[model samples]
Target: MSRYPLRSTLFFLCPLFSGLLACFIWAATLPPAAAQERGGGQTPSLGFAPRPKESAPDKELRFLRDSTAAAAISADELLEDRERKRVIGRGFADLRFLGKRVQADHIEVQTETRDAVATGNIIFQAGNDRIVGSRIDFNLDSERLVIYDAKGYLGATYYITGNVVRRISVDRYEVIDGTFTTCEGDKPDWAFHSRKSTFQIEGYAHLQAPLLSLRGVPAAALPYAIFPIKSKRETGFLIPTIGYANRNGLEFSPRFFWAINKWSDATFGVDYYEKRGSRYLGEYRYILSKDTAGQFNTTYFKDKLEKTTLWDIKSSHISSLPGGWGFSAVTDFASRKNDDRSLERNLNDRVRQDTDTRLELTPNLKGIPGSLRVAMRRREGLRENDGDLFQKFPHITLDVSQSQIGSSEFRYSLGSSATSFYRVQNKKTTVLQRFDAAPSVSLPVQTVPWLGVTANFGLRYTYWTDQKRTPDVPGNPSRDDQKQSPLSREIWFSSLGVAGPRFSRVYNGGFGPFRDFKHILSFQTTYSYAPAMDSRDRKLIIPIDNVDAFNDQNTVSYGIVNRVLTKLKTGEGFETRQLFTASLTQSADIAEARREQNLSANPRRPFGDVVLDIQSRPISLIRFTHEAIYDPYEHEIDEQTTGLLLEGGRNWYLGLDRTWRRKRSRGRDPQSGRSDLNFSAGYGLTRRWFLEYLTRINNVQNITLQQS
Candidate 1:
């Protein structure tokens, strides 16, 4: 058995010998290039790898291949030397396989661990972000880049630092013993520093620290914090606002946001006041589609016996209708809670029953394509005083018209409307109930020259029901039903204006004895007349109706005189233009002759007002106004007002205003003739410093000052 085992062992040894001989022959026959290709070195492989030598141009990037000071070197975008390779560059040098760069004065590369060790002004740009350090060790095989004594920018938004940094990904990193700052790059605030942080390159970060400094001065330390740097819909706790008020005392409001979706969101918050207890509020808004959107807000509070709250909700929708029509609707509602304190003690009197409603719809309307409109509105208020308590009956209106009605004559037509009033708080007052329908037809003759005349006719009917107090007799003129009965009437009228373009010219710059400056001015005039109306006198008038006696006339003489407009351009970004228009106006009153004789009063002077417009480029504003009222008959100024504004500069502004009035002999206050001056000023000295002042001085030296 021993001999047999020995024979097996010998057979195995013979093959092993033959294999060794074959290897020796192969190695002896190989070329020198082949040996070198196999990473063979002239010297025996040592535990320490040799360092690469520095390249020329002294300022270029070079690599250290070993711990020794001198070694062979390779200068390339990529270096692949087994002994070792390091970059010595003034700016930057990258080790490709290691997936790292060294921006340092000196760097040492090692093959055992396959890492580049850096020193002196070292920076590593890995992926999108970068890091700076006094020293660094980067591992190519592990794709791990680490730094010590580091500071640099994080994705361009925040300045970051850590005693050690281990980048997990292009967008993710782990920072130990770190600091965060708003200063970019290597700049330091010196006031703000962190102990530890985990940051995300995608606009968020988680921080953990015992204390954080502001401007390098310690403010407060937080155990943990989560911040979002991206501006978008994000859910988080918001900064709290705090203030002191006489009624609420020291109050703090903290809000929270909920990121719902791209089209909708919500916000909720709470108020903690020292004297007023706590209050909660919520607001929600969203867009349903391209043409539909709405918002709602509500607030609630608590008390012992009686709690008061208010909720407001509003919604609107715009929809495309069949044909070329469009539809729009808006709705709003408010509800209030009332209890003992609110009603009896008047602590919260404004919470009493108050409701307002409005609804409208249109089909094939004018101006708007394809519109017809039907709308109703009502409002009610409950109050303790008879004069304060009031109610509005549902006022209904229906109107239909076309945008471009006729070719030769663009005619617009309107249907009548109906409304009624039925309630009054005072028992001595009678309820007013009435229905009115007024239909009007307007035909405007037009041509390419923008000159034409128009004719209009309107018919109106009113049904009225009058009530009387049950107190006195008719002869004595006490409230009686005999004189207050129902009345019905129909009124008709036709109006015509032979309107054609009336053009006039004017010359400006006649002021300050400077006739040298000239300007062109234009004017237009319109003369209209209306035939006598059949319904001149009436037993009753429509409630909630705008009295149009101001716009009526037998012959209205209106001419736009001296339409003066100014034009100028300046490089200082301040351009001002003023347009002044004057017109003679009057009301058409067929019964004016009788009213003047019977009333025994001054005949109303043709009521007229001059229009003025001013546009300024510096402040980017347009103003339409009328300030000076001249009594043409008396040849004196009745009322005057002046207003001006200036807007420019980063933290500066200015404005001015003045007003004056004349008192009449019959009805005038003792101090009515005095002029009033009101002015306000504000300025921002710096980004964080602001100042504001307001003053109102009457003729009696009643001066008011406000500041911020």
Candidate 2:
């Protein structure tokens, strides 16, 4: 000690030895630089020794350097917020602390006039995304922080070390210019690079001039783009259609829809064809309540080529109408004028048949105007021959049955129609005002044993006028010679009785020789009377026109025909009594039957006929018809017709008919002709094939296939 220069020797030599020992101990016992500040402390410097920026070799810095060795910050202040906590290290302004406990090895810190920088190797964080980069920087006063070329980790996952930075109280940024992506870290096929980007502290980002490359090709390029921070709904346009059709040529349809209220909406679109022009359509729908809704849709087209117009309108209201009344209306109109007159030749003569208006109201209306029946209807038909005729018009009807007057067993209906008809040939126009009211009277008189007598009365009246036609023969007595009359009257009466068999018999066998078979016999009789008188010169014909025969008593004309049956058991089946079994028929010549004129001179008198039918198995059917003439005094056979038909299923079928006229001749080659025979037969060859033969010996031809 005496030889070395006392003060210098003690300062330099002793402190140097002490610093060496301290360095050795720190390197051995303390945690790594990253571990030293792992929890909360001043981070140890690595890349560069902790040092304040030189200040012009100023007095204060020099004084501080002389007064104390650099103020050493402890590891605790390294991880704490320097600005908010207002905590500072005074003993050491620039600090370095190497640690032995944590995993990382490198740590760094630098201080400048306005900021402080800290950087190090960030270790693998078990649950967080891993990043690897070069460096990180932080501004103390501004509380801005940045990481540069810093590599971070979570387990084995590591990202490219470019930037993973957060500037306190400022913003965050992940520089991806040199970034590589790998869903499988071994061999990545895609990469991303961006010139610059801004990211919110909350984690959303806006990138600039970003390029996404896949398999070495530029997948996407965006000058600027924004990404949503959360999931949300989006609005956009739809794709248009492109297609072609033969008649319509090239076609295109563009459609769009808008969602408006929760209960209502609309859609509109257009259909365009290069050849046929374009059409537009729109639909609107609304829900008035939970149970009721209304919808309307319409379409229209105006052809540029032909100047034709077409449109359809439809409106419907569902069960939601008031009082459970639903309404529907459809109106469609179309008119097409041929683009070229020659085109009409290719199509059928096009006559438009369209309904001008169609309205349907249902279920006893409450929502509709008046009642369920409060409606007006109109329609027209167009035909080449008819030109234009009002087939139906605006006819209105109301429910008048609230004053329900008819019996429950019967119904009373009253209706009227105003209509017009145009004749094609004569070109005559006729207008009609028609009224009808039918109240049917039915009285069922049950007279046991005697019969069930029923009386029914029907009344029908018509008032009309005709533009009378002048007869070709001026003096002819035919109806054509009569002039039109304004008024007329007709009165009719009908009465009938229904009777049952009082006595019945069954014969087990024959009528004569080979005619033996099972037979059933029953007898019944029905009587009817009808009289009609009218001053209407033109007598109205009914289903049956009554002719006089056995008159004075109820003629078998208006009601049921009277008959007694005697069924005979025969080999071919039971043979019916041909005499009594005939059709109950009346004459069409009302005036002639009324006079009942018969005699060689007046032999063309009206006649009444009756026919009977019988059928028995393979022998088929047999019919016998007899006509009785009325000469206003006597009844005799005027005409008789017999017909028979036989069939054996798929094997064969045969039919024969004969007719005989009964007009007296008086040597004039007989006023009436003899019987004419007609026959037909069919025989099946197989299940689905057949042969047929037919003949009308005295008349026409007829033939057919049976099993085809």
Candidate 3:
């Protein structure tokens, strides 16, 4: 019964499934044959079947095939043999493997070994290297190549040609009977030929038996030469500089650089002058740390004509340490024998040779209240003209903080110094040692925003050890007492009070090109009084330091300052600028009335000269400045100077200056003046050309004194 049931079920389902299969076959065959051909017919079945395990030889062969097949090979005609695993391509054959490409007229490749040979106009390219040869043999898997009768371009900036070329790696090559040049075309402007040469990419080239040629003509020969192929710092001989000057005749300077380490380098050079003697120069640079660096240079020459040896040395160093300590030193020293005749023609060199050398070290301490610093310095000078220099060997100074006084509004400061001033001239030395201490306290009171006042009191004390030299008298017999050493001390006190009121206003209306305008007016009157010292105390005091005895003064100085500021809108942002400023100052001596002046019993004049200063920039391109000192009592201007500057587009500029000095002698005319005028202008004639002119005129003499 079970068998019969199963048979029945199959009998019913079999016919239905047969009918569906027949329908599918009919539908598949319904497309036209032409359509099937155009679509390349049905795709072959990719069966889901496991492959046999590969043997070692099979795996090796597969690896070689894969390496060779990584790139594509194409040709107009191709012949392949599967049995031998070889391919032969002709008629414009090309191959590309990895990043290397090769094109040839005829090519042969062995897939199993990944080897290739090409002949007849072969061109190969890899990275920046391009090679053209008659024949090439290459191994794809090893990336080794050998070329015969090859010429190539290296980095597109250099050319190399050789009878035989061998590539060792991507960045290294060896050539036999090769020529190298930076020029183009059949005949280059300059070239080097060598018997054997080796090139390292982005590094350098080494040549054996190199001969330099210019325009196909041999110029120089070297036993062996090493040249830089990359623009990097390396230890090498630099290109010699050749020049000719009227004073030096033909000059040749050759330099050699030594790359001592990553942070230091030195260059040594020799300059040969055909007319003059040779000069030796050396420069050294070092970077000790991020914030510490230094340079030292020296130049020495022996002049045959002058029969003297001259040398100049310059060195500078700057260092910053932790805890706000800093140090700097600059030294410029030159030979003293040729002060009148300098070996260098540059004015700046001559000035440096005559200048002094200075070294300084400073340590600072900072806090919320203020900062304090201590400095030590040394100075030395060279040349006869610098003989009067006040040499300070290890002068020390201390500046204390300006701290608040006991939590009050007053602030106090202290400054002290000990210095030794010495002068050496004509084999004679004079020295003066001094110690100075000054302490000051100030209270700044601001009753309102517009009004402010400050009261200050200070005391200065100084002690000096002095050396004096008296002048020789023609008819006196005190020559033996010309030298004396005196010790002295002085102390003084000073008090000062300053008060001022400041006013400012802003206007919102647009005026011409200005978007807004403001006016600031400040007026200040200062009255100072100090009583004269006693005659007895003044006689015992000698002024050896910068401090002087107190002088009797009772004076009032008044000043008015006016400023006009304008705001303009710019493409980037709003800009505020001061358009104009004017100031006037005058003083009156209050105690002058107590002095008797003339035979008519008139009191002395109390008013001093009036000073006016004005600076204005009415337009963006023009500016004017004027300053004058006027004696109101004499009705004359003592000194006056006015300057005007105009700047325009594209290097166009003009400047005019005039200065006038009036004679102060009583017999001279009050209005008589000596005037000088200077004019300078610069204009662009073209984008690359410009014209500049400068001239000075003596107006009183009606003559042009200088023009350039």
Candidate 4:
């Protein structure tokens, strides 16, 4: 193992540090290499046995392992001299000792010194390393070998030829006038020419006075360089990306990957914006066990033109805790309001409007027949500098599974949570503590095939501390409000939900591939009322979240959902799929009798807009979806979205979507002009190759918003 087991990285570094290769040489220091089983350490005795005279004249001789040494030798002829304790072999001479082998046309050895000399096409082999030269001088005692005019390869990749290759010691080597390359064939794609190079087996390779050539053309100059060798991932410079963009000019990004260990790794790089500035990026990943893993990625950039610095970060973690507990976390954060627009590198991530950071834990509460959860959540707008943001911390919740009420026709479930709410808008910040609990029960009053009725009722109690009556705004509090006397509120709420008269029909499909098709329809309604609080009482409650100011919702929401399911027979079995789905919903606010619209300041009629949604999948490959909101007063669609999709399970895909709006705009909100069409398509040329195209066009602007 080379000091850097990922030696492939050196192939690129050698060419990059060509001129400086001669200035650096690392002396790798590691534990000594393992030696073959031997009778004695370091210097082992040597023994030689010659072929018997009675054997055929052309038959070669073989040596037997004896007490003197565990070495084997074979040759066409062998001669021994007791006076000098020397042995000589001629013709096809081979020697194997201490896990190393040597082959030569002729060989001579001094058994006393444990030194050997070989000439005429000498070949040496040790471990995975092999070398061929005309002559060699080796010391079995020191296990040091030097080959003259050597040419061979290292680690199955570095093909090296040198004037003199010498193994100074076990796991250490030096080569003079060496030229090496990773490319194969008679002519390599590129090669490094160096005056001298040294190797620390399974560690690093150092070269001096090295020059790189690409396709026989000199590419770079380096006096010296040190390269770490590791498998696959390594600590080294990676291939750089270069391109030209009108906004960024000539861009170049260089990256480096560090394989910290088997379970962890990291990558650091710098992206050149040319016109803007340089951006530094880093990512780290680690796995502690099969169920534990985490990763973090971050970026920092300072724009010269904009004269602003920006930062972005992303992280995710999942782990299994002791005692049947699980934990996970996710974060996407930006230091600046528009950091996503200024610094986000991912196309999809930049289009998102907000960043959500959350951490959650699920624990097994002993003897509890319900799930327990603890979590903290934060939502930040990517483009909002001073809008209200939600920050909930230490939100603890428990959900008890529905259980029978003494074997009665009624069952009940309990759900409750306690949370600390923190909200910030502009320069003001609001903080409050909230505790809520709700327990609900349902009775199956009717269970006929055509008419089914289920009635549900629940009571919810909530308490808020450190609260201040906020103005009638979208969760925005002024800075001075924090100084006002804090107040607390204890509120009670109730809700009722009913479902009945669900209709269904099954149609035998003698028509397409569908074996059977069924259509089902259901109607559901819920009425919720919270004691209407006076304006002053409501003001005592800070609107820190969507649910905070809503202690006065005397409203009812009713909706009908219908589905068409189709069953298809696969070769293995049968599968059911919802082929079509549709829903229409609307709600009336009776307490207020009028509610403001999202984009308009004026309160509208009590009757809310009717929202209709439909989805149809006639076949496995084709799908269609549509949604529309009808304004009762305007008698027109206030907003609409529709899309179609065609899927090719393995090779192709197409999707087209359009969004339209009639409402006016609010500050910093998404534009609501003419419909915008988004189209995307992809086709696979081969199993491993594909091409895709995507574009978004704005009809109002009459320009392409985005295309790729």
TM-scores for every candidate against the unseen true structure: 0.52, 0.31, 0.53, 0.59
State the lDDT of candidate 2 residue by residue for 619-687, as single tens digits. Answer: 234333334332333444555566666767545777777666654757754344555666667764322
RMSD to truth, every model: 21.4, 33.8, 24.0, 13.4
Q: How many residue pairs clash in each candidate?
A: 29, 49, 0, 35
- CA lDDT of every candidate: 0.49, 0.40, 0.67, 0.71
The lDDT, on a scale of 0 to 1, for candidate 2 is 0.40
The Cα error of candidate 4 at residue 169, in Å, is 29
Per-residue lDDT over 615-686 for candidate 1, one digit per residue giving the tens place of the 0 to 100 score: 223223323334666655566676777777665453556667778887766666633675777676666432
Model 1: per-residue Cα lDDT at residue 708: 15
Task: Count clashing pairs, candidate 3.
Answer: 0
Report lDDT (Cα) of residue 168, candidate 4: 85
Model 4 / residue 223 / CA error / Å:
34
Which order, best to worst by lDDT?
Answer: 4, 3, 1, 2
Model 2 TM-score, 2 decimals: 0.31
How well does candidate 3 match the true structure in TM-score terms? 0.53
